[model samples]
Target: MNPKISDFGLARTFGGNQIESNTNRVVGTYGYMAPEYAGNGIFSIKSDVYSFGVLVLEIVSGEKNRGFVHEEHSNNLIGHAWELQNEGRSMELVAKCLGESINVSQVLRSIHVGLLCVQRHPEDRPTMPSVIMMLGGEGPLPSPKEPGFYVGNSTQGFYDGSYGISSNSEPSITKLNGT
Candidate 1:
C-alpha cells in the first residue's frame, strides 16, 4: 500500500497572499519535517514541499528515514539516496520489490524531483507548479543541492545507540535488519 496520510497536526491557515508563518508548538514528523520548521518553527509553503520530498523518498526506497541504518555508513535514508545519486547509481535507490516492472525513467524523475524539493534552502525548492511540470516531463530538471538535516559519515560497524533520536510524537519506528 502507498503512503496514505490522513492528518497534519500542525497545519495552520494562511491568509490572502500569505506564504509563511511561525509556530511555537513545533510539531511534525521528525524525518519528514523541514529543517527550518523543525528548528525555528518557521514554516512556509516550502515546508510542505520538503515533507513531500521525504514521502517520495520513502515510497521509492521502501525505507523510513528516521529508522534507516546502513552498515557501511551512518547516513539515514535521505543521505543514502543522495549518495547513490551522486555516484550515478540512482537505480540502486529503488525498492528491490519493484522488480522488472518499474519504469526506469519515471523512477529516476521522481527521485530527482524529490531531492529538489528537499533542498536545504527553501528558496531552492521548486514551487508546487514547477514540481508538477518537471514530474510530467515538461522540462529538464536542474541538479539538486545538499538536503537539510542530513547526517552522513563513513563508518562500518554496528549502530551502537549513539544516534537515532526521534523528535516527533509519532510512534517509535523499529527497523529489523536481516543478514
Candidate 2:
C-alpha cells in the first residue's frame, strides 16, 4: 500500500482476493490513458506506467509532450529530449523549479528512461520491472530505438484514414524473374 498512490482518483474497489476483473465504466484522465485502454476498455499495471511516464516528463521538463510546442522547433518533448540528449545537453530539459538542486545527469537519465517508457510500441516499451530497475540504478539499460510515427515523413501519414494511395490511380507492376 503506497501511501502516495492509495488515494488516486482512478483507484477502484475489488474483492480482497479476486484477480482479473472487468469494468463497465471506463474513466480516467485523457492524456494519462494507454492507447489500448482508451481505444478499448482494457486496463492494467502497464497503463499506470504510461501515465507515470507522462507525469515524470511533465514534472522534470515543466512541459506536456502531448501538446508541447516550441517557437524554434516542430518536435515534441520526446523529440526534444532525444535531441538534447544526443547533443549532451539534457540539462536544458529540466524544470526551473528544481533550480540547482537537481542533478543534470540524473535528470537527463530520467528523461531518457521516460521516453523509453512511453514508446509507441507496447512491446518496445519496458516492463514495470525494467522501469523500476532503471529508476533504482539496478542494471545497464538498453539503448532506446527510435520512437514510432516519427514526425516529418511525407510517405507516412495519420493514424486514422489519411494517407492511402488509391490502386485505381496507379498501374500495378508485375516483376518476372528473368525480365
Candidate 3:
C-alpha cells in the first residue's frame, strides 16, 4: 500500500513559513531516517526525501537498506549502488526477478534519483518537485555524492543489546536530541 505522510506516527506538522524543526527526541525506523534527523534530531523536508529515496532503492532492488551485506565488499546497499554507479554498472542494481520486463533506462534513472535523495547533506538532496522533474526526464541530474551512514559494516550501536534483540531489530522507542 502507498503510505501517507500521516501514517508515520512520528511525523510533526508545521505552520506558516516554517520549514524545519528541532527536537530533543528522535525516533523512527533506523534505515529510513536521514542522518541529520537520526544523528542530530534535525527534521526537515530533505529528511523525508531521504527516506523516499531509500524506499525507491528498496523497491528497485528488492533489498532492505538496513542489514544489507555484500560478500565481495563490506558496503551496504547504498554504498554498493554508489560503487556500481561509479563503475558504470548501475544496471546491476535492478532485481533479477524484474528480468526482461524491466526497462533498463528507467531503472538506471531511478537508481540515480535514489542516490540523489540520499546524498550526505540536506541541501544536496533534491526537493520533491525537483525529484519528480528529474524522474520525468526534465533535466540532467547531477552526479550523486556519498550517502550518509555509508559504513562498511553493521555496528552494534544501532541495537539495544539489553533487550536481547538482534542489531537489525527495531526498538520499541528511540530518543535523540537536536542542537
Candidate 4:
C-alpha cells in the first residue's frame, strides 16, 4: 500500500535556482502539520520531516492522533511516546495488532527514527537523505531531544467558569497528604 510520492498533492518542483514563494493558503493535516507551517505559513523540507514523524508515530501505534487518548495523562500521542521512550520501555507503546512475531529491535529502531524526525528543534532533525541512511542501517542515528509541544510544564490554564471567564494558573497549592 505504498503511496506514490509523485501523486502527493503537496509535491511540487521549484526549478533550478528559483526563489521560493509564500502564501496565506495554509493547507495540511492537523496533527501532522509542522509548527512553523501551522503558525507562520512557512514550509520547508523540515516541515516534511515533521509530518513524517507524525506519520511514523501513527503507524507504529495504530492510532489516529485526531482522537488519541491517554487515560492518565495531559498529553497526546506524541507526548506519551516521548515519555515511553525516556523510560526505556518504548515497546510498551506499540500497537497490539503487531502481535508476538514483531521484531523488538526493528520496532525500537522505527520509534527512534520517528522521534528523531519530530525533535522540537527543526535543525536537530535528520534530512531525508540522512533518514534514509539511518533507516537502511548504513549510518548511526544521532540522539533525539525533547519533541515539540511536550506537556511537562507545571503551569496550566484553567477556566474560572464565572461569567464565562478563563484564567491561567499553576499547579494547585496544597499541603501533603492527609492535610
Candidate 5:
C-alpha cells in the first residue's frame, strides 16, 4: 500500500528518549487526536498510535470516527466498537460491503489490535512494533482497555467549546504560536 501522509504544519521532531513533547498550543484533527494530546498539550509516540487505531477502525467500519452517530447508542466509532467488542459482537462493526468476502478471524483480530492501540491511557497502548506482531498473529493479544475520547450520552463541551462543528469537517489543521 502506497500510504501518503500530508499536513505536517503542526508537526515537530524529537530525538533521543524524549517521547513526550509539551506544547502551549495544540492543533490537529479532533477524531484522530489522542486524548492526552487533545486534553493537554502533550504529544508523544503513543499519541500517534492512538490516531492509527482510529484510522484502523474507520477503515474497518467504513465510517468516520468523529462524526459517527447511532440511534441505539450515542458514541463515536471508537466507543461503538469498544461496546461491541465488550459484548463479543465486534464483527458487527465490519462494513457491510465486506460481507462474507473477508476472513472473519483476521477481521476480528484486526479489531482487537485496533482497540489495543486506542486505549485511554498511552501506557496501555502497544508500541508500533508490538502492534505489527499482534496484527501478524505472532503472539497472544491482550484485552484492550477503554478507548480515549469515548463520549457517551453527554453533550459535554470538549476543549473550550470547539467540539461538534469542527469534528464534522475535513481534517482540521490549526497553527498556534507557542509562547
Candidate 6:
C-alpha cells in the first residue's frame, strides 16, 4: 500500500485485486486525463500517472494544459514543453517568476518525467514507483518519446453551422419520417 497515494481523491472504485477496468461513461478533468481513459473509458494506475505528469508540467510552467497556447505555436502546454525540450531550450519552459529561485536540474528532470508520463501509449508510461525513482534521480532516465496530444502545427478557426461556406442566413431544414 502506497501511503503517498492513500490520502488523495481516487478516480476509480474497484476491488483491491483489480489492476484495470473499463466504463462506458468517461469522467474527470479532461486536461489531466490520459488519452485511453478519455477516449475509450479505460482506467488504470497509468491514467493517474498521466494526470500527475500534467500537474507537474502545469506547476513548472504555470500554464493550464486545456487552454494553454503559445503566441507563435498552436500547441498546448504539453506540446510547447515537448518543443522546448526538442529545441534544447527546456529552461524556457520554466515560469519567468521562478527564474534563479528554482533548482535548474530538478526542474528539467521534472519536465522529462512529465513527458514520459504522458507518452502517447499507456504502456510507454512508467509505473508510479518508477516515476518516483526517476524524479528522485535513483538511476539514469530514459529519453522520452513523443508525447500524447502533440497536435503539431494545428490551426485555429471557428466553424459555424454552415460548414466552410459563409452563410449569414439559416439553411432550410429537411426531416424525413418513415411512417
Output the number of the TM-score-best candidate: 5
Task: Name the lDDT value of residue 150 in candidate 6.
Answer: 69
Tens digits of lDDT, candidate 2, 23-123: 44455654455444444445555555666666777889998766677777666566566667667787888988888887766777788788776655556
Clashing pairs in 3: 26-176
All candidates' lDDT scores? 0.73, 0.57, 0.72, 0.63, 0.74, 0.71
lDDT tens string, model 3, 1-179?
12223223233354334467676666777678877676666777778788888888999999988777788976668778888888999888888989899878888999999999988788999877778788889467799987866654334232231212232323334735446
lDDT of 1: 0.73
Residue pairs with clashing backbones, model 5: none
| Superposition TM-score, candidate 4 onto the true structure | 0.74
Candidate 2 ranges with C-alpha deviation above 4 Å: 1-27, 36-44, 148-179
Evaluate model 5: give its TM-score.
Answer: 0.79
TM-scores for all candidates: the values are 0.78, 0.61, 0.78, 0.74, 0.79, 0.78
Can you list the residue pairs that collide in candidate 4?
none
Model 3: CA > 4 A from native: 1-12, 152-179
Tens digits of per-residue lDDT for model 5 on 51-111?
8888889999999986788889667889899999999999999999997799888889899
Please give, for residues 53-77, the per-residue lDDT of candidate 1 as tens digits. Answer: 8898999998888778899887777
